[model samples]
Target: MNAGHQTTRRLAAGAGKSICRSCRDSLSRNYASAAAAAVQTEDHVSQHIPPVAQASPQTSYQVNAGVVLSRPPQITRDLHPFESAFFLYQRRLNERSALPFTRYFYYKERTPADREWKRKIKQRLTPARDIGRYKGYGEEAWNDEVLVGAKESDFNWQVERLLEDAETTGVEDQPAQELTETTPSPLAQKKVEHEAVERPMSRITEADKKNDVKSLNRLLQRTLYFLVKNKEGQWMFPQDGLQKETLKEAAHRVLEYSAGVNMNTWIVGNVPIGHYQLDYPTSRKTESGLNELGLKTFFMKARIMAGQANLKENQFGLQDFQWLAKEEVKTQVEDKYWRSIKNMLAER
Candidate 1:
């Protein structure tokens, strides 16, 4: 009872002292932290308050200096009614008179030498043999005959005989002398001259004359029928069909002719007179011979026309005609270009 109890009491006293010391250390730390926080808060307040006061005047002065001067109020005067109307009318007239790129087409047409050269080159290469054959000169077999001063009728006869021989023997390499080159009958010469005079000025060579007429006839017939069918509505030709290089060439010829001129004739139209400011290369062949906006306008019109029109089907269940109308055909040519751009973007 004496020794064990005393030892236990001593251990409890030591533990109590240790707990009190720990509590005192915690209190001291808490007080020190609180003091430091108070000092920091005072410093922050002091710093911010002086800056705010000091900067307020300067900021106010700067803002006041930066203020823009108010502009004077405009006069409330209005134009007279007649003046307004006249101005509007003049503006409209100016707008109507201003053709954007139509002048370029007319200018290009006026200068026919370049087109003639191009046509000649094409004729020299392809020769429009089918047309020549139909005209009585088997293909362009009479090119040399015509060049050699053979009479028109004589050339025609030679062409007919050559075509007949070619058809029968499936060979176009017949001897030149073997093809009869008799003197042309007077009646035949007169007929040839009359037809030649009546023919539209085109890039058509003598060999291509018959073929051009035949092709034109086919196109005209198809166009007429298509138009008749859609007499009550508008129509558009599919651009994809006319987008062929050959067809484009044909279209260019048609356009050239429709503008009231050809490869040999001067341009005759209500051509606008203005300096053409082309944003693109003039030498390059554009879809509608117009800029991006013009092309868009054309396509939109075409889409409207196509939506309103009825599509004609041929005996073979194919579209017999290439272009429905000039506008539609122009649109078809232009739509392909924008669609191509859209496709490229989608891929990216």
Candidate 2:
């Protein structure tokens, strides 16, 4: 044989030696792996959900599309002690580094708003953002964990205003000569423009005070997940058997079926974020006599936008339900199941 023919034969031998190593070794994996059917069966066995025998073409899992329905944090999370100190340090650094804000640039020499701004600066002014749900005042600038007691009617702004009103009443109640000394005019209140203090509603709602797990208003500062109790009293996320539809379609159907259509929810994506599997105690047979082995649950994330779940009717198989935080959910769900699913949950 010629030199070129010999080189072609050697190349063929090398190719034969390195053939199908990954196909044979299914345990091997990579983050970049776009693994399809070739790696699927081996991974299933590794998961130990159903026996290796059950991975055959005849045996099958009852595929379920689960909705990890959640209410995102209504308020910012509370800072840790270190975080708070660090932020305070950073603020001081910023204060030292920054040039003094020149009043002449933005404001005329003296006006009501400008005077108010000046008076506020003397008291170390902090402007409040008035966004509807996530709003907070000076002292209430972090989490919305407030005491919804009998005293809830006394919001911070109103309390301060009431004190001011009392002081004004004292001044008004004084004799004419004393009033002359105290006030530029008896209508001193008129001089100040009667700055109205609009009392903001307390963040703590009735649902929070009651510690109602069924209600969505419990934790304003933490993500709340939707869970349903099965007929056996096993608590898990709302899920249903997949029909002849896409995973996302099945997830929507499952959410509506298990939790009712009263809620306005948005599924985060079309694909599953996590996978979990569990096998039945006994190997059951399908209608076609193939082994009905176990369950394979595909979790898809969704956020509750407007309404809440109505499990009162119990129209579906579920008997009880709750909107629980991640830690609370871990306590309720099975250890193995929680282990399979915990990584998908929000840290806080």
Q: Estimate each model's TM-score.
A: 0.14, 0.61
TM-score of model number 1: 0.14
Candidate 2 residue-wise lDDT, 1-348, digit = tens: 443445445555677866465632332333214344546777877788764454477777889888899999987765665554454445434443332556566677766556545444432323221111222345544543322332322334435544454333333244567545555674653634444556545567788899999888778888999999987899999888888999989888888888878999999988899989999998789888778789999999999998878776645678889999999999999999999999999976
lDDT of 1 by residue, 1-348 (tens): 343345445555777755565565565566666667888999999988765343322111000000000111112223465554454445433433442435444446535543333333233232233222212235643333222232322434435543543333211232234222221244223322211123223333453344432122323212211211113232222221123334334333333322212223221222211111213322333354422321211110101111112223221122322323233333433454334322211110
Clashing pairs in 2: none
Q: What TM-score, to 2 decimals, does candidate 2 have?
A: 0.61
lDDT of each: 0.31, 0.69
Could you say which candidate leads in TM-score? 2
Q: Candidate 1 deviates by what RMSD?
A: 30.1
Instruction: Tell me model 2's lDDT, rounded to 2 decimals.
Output: 0.69
